[model samples]
Target: MAEQGPHFLMVGGVPRDWRDKRTVAEAVFNDPLPFLDVESAHTHEVLSSAMAAELVDLGEGIIDVASVRGRNRLLTRAIAGAHYSGVIEI
Candidate 1:
């Protein structure tokens, strides 16, 4: 049997406070890069950790793309305009 792969997504949203907690909502859709939300039903933490591991410069800070176009631009730069592959947790 083939092993299931991790899902990835270029998430973008505005920072907001909810009951003294931070959250992001009102998400927008990009050009459907790659869909893979199979693990979302299990645990969000696991998903986050996997993404962090894959991302090289995922430092301790909030980087907002705020739009699909912005995310595409970032991806292009991150992968040096190469045909990169990843999944989205949409």
Candidate 2:
């Protein structure tokens, strides 16, 4: 079974374990990353620990990309033009 989310996705886990099932929601926003919620009757192909790690790695990459993009944008703007910050005298 494959779980897809905003973060890393994996294709293995113990699916539909009643012991781990929940009524409302298994994990809250503060729970953590790589929340393994297998679908009913589905069998996971990956281990829980591995899935969590993969997800964390994915999230980290996304953050790194954002940081790099921000720096690149600032550099591009600096080279493209300038701004007048001080007030002009009448």
Candidate 3:
């Protein structure tokens, strides 16, 4: 199968930005409270990698964004870093 969207990865214990689907799927998943913007997906929501990293750092052991081994490193790291667990769509 071919991955077809912007993928994310966990770097430096945080989720960084990348368009690689394979890399985004190999990891867990995370959902930040302040980062939720489901209104628009076509227009790029401006957010820096540093900010994202900071979010992950703040949410350490409190979230999971992983979907595969290395595909979604950030997701996986977030999952490992989560403090609370539940369902959230953002």
How much lDDT does each candidate structure score? Answer: 0.38, 0.33, 0.37
Question: Model 3 scores what on Cα lDDT?
Answer: 0.37
Between 1 and 2, whose TM-score is larger? 1
TM-score of each: 0.20, 0.15, 0.18
For model 3, what is the error of residue 33's alpha carbon versus the real structure, in angstroms, after optimal superposition?
Answer: 26
lDDT of 3 by residue, 1-90 (tens): 556445443355343333354373564458544444323432112222323564465443322222223454565444333312322223
Worst 10 contiguous positions by lDDT, candidate 2? 81-90
Model 2 segments more than 4 A misplaced:
1-37, 40-47, 60-90
Report the lDDT tens digits of candidate 2 across residue range 21-48: 6456564586443432233122122222
Report the C-alpha lDDT of model 1 over 45-87, residue by residue, as the tens digit: 4333444443445332222332212444553343332223444
The lDDT leader among the candidates is: 1
Q: In model 2, which residue pairs have backbone atoms overlapping below 3 Å?
A: 12-45, 12-46, 13-44, 13-45
